[model samples]
Target: MACLKLDARALNGLWNADHWERELSDPRRICVGIAEGSDNLSAVACGWIVLDELQITVVAVDPEHRRQGLGRTVLKQLLLDASSAGARQAFLDVAEDNHGALALYGALGFHTIGRRSGYYRNGKDALIQSLELQTDIKLN
Candidate 1:
């Protein structure tokens, strides 16, 4: 899929096309995507709604499209949609060394709630961050 191509350029073995395909088929999953053309995906944010929570699974942006607010745009859309769908909170696990992602999440009001040691295949620690979402929350 288009996300797989962007994933190869932006992500590091986080999730594969097969895994994404399976997850995308689930009814509780929500995704927001931005594409330059029919075949060029610029950025994407995906999450799963569970009870009153939104579990942000992945956010990927093409390396060529970084630092242009694409990630923030898509993620904000995801959060808005999830809130509308009855999600009261949002959470995600970001690699400890992924400063860019940490900063983005921080700017979005997500704070570190926990950590997972050696969470990734590359042995990076994963910082669990969470945000309390309100139906009228303004994500800016």
Candidate 2:
């Protein structure tokens, strides 16, 4: 719902309503979202659980809602959900130039593991990062 509104504003049209519906229907997927109001979302984060690992698929914050901790809140909840689902670690690829995201991930204890050249449609390099999850980790 919120992601559908963000398709053009934040996701660059990489996903649609149907895509969200399908992913939401999957039992192995974890999604966390923060709503701005009854009909709008401020931030969202989602990941897929595979065995003991979590592959983070999406993390988006509406432009108007950036830099207000919404991204951090949703992501923390998503990671907690993944950990509760038996994920021992988490992984994600972020564009190299996305300083905000890199800072957020770093603060959350994610370390760079690899890089992919020209990984995005805009020719940006992707930095792969990973974080070890602890079932008892304090998120507050």
Candidate 3:
């Protein structure tokens, strides 16, 4: 749920991270399926963006809300939003152990562009992937 997102506590800090917000602040930035009205307060994806470069900082659905397709919906929205913005591409770093996440990005047209060794606090590595955007299609 939104409450369980790593950025949950930093919700307020969003205003301070306004450089990204300045460009991502469109009320219609993206369509968040099941973004609200979940049984719990969150049951949604927690994300951020810089132009078309979207970041899936955290996405936690309430146990009660699992398997309902909310997670994928949120991811789709983030990708669409970034593509609609100006991002020539979008990138995310997923822990090597997170097979599900890797699959999601792969299914969404993201490709592993690089890797960061010991990128996690627990010494886990990370896969950095990106989705290239068509500049001609980017909106102002």
Candidate with top TM-score is: 1
Error of 2 at 63 (Å): 0.7
Pairs of residues clashing in candidate 1: none
Tens digit per residue, CA lDDT, model 3, 38-138: 53343334355665466655444444565666666666666566566655666678888888677666766778888999997789999988776563222
TM-score, every prediction: 0.94, 0.92, 0.63
Q: Write the per-residue lDDT of candidate 2 for residues 1-140, one digit (tens) a residue.
A: 66788656777778888898977789889888888677687788999999999999999998888999988999999998988888999999999999999999988888899999999999999999999998333466
- Order candidates by lDDT, high to low: 1, 2, 3
Better of 2 and 3 by lDDT: 2
Q: For residues 1-140, write the lDDT of model 1, one tens digit per residue.
A: 88888778888656788988976788999989999888899999999999999999999999899999999999999999999999999999999999999999988888998999999888999999999998334576
lDDT of each: 0.90, 0.87, 0.57
> Residue 111 of candidate 2: its Cα lDDT?
88
lDDT of model 1 at residue 47?
96
Descending-TM-score candidate ranking: 1, 2, 3
Q: Pick by lDDT: which candidate is best? A: 1
- In model 3, the Cα lDDT at residue 9 comes to 42
Model 2 error, position 102 (Å):
0.3
Tell me how far the alpha carbon of residue 20 in candidate 2 is from the true structure, in angstroms, after superposition.
Answer: 1.5
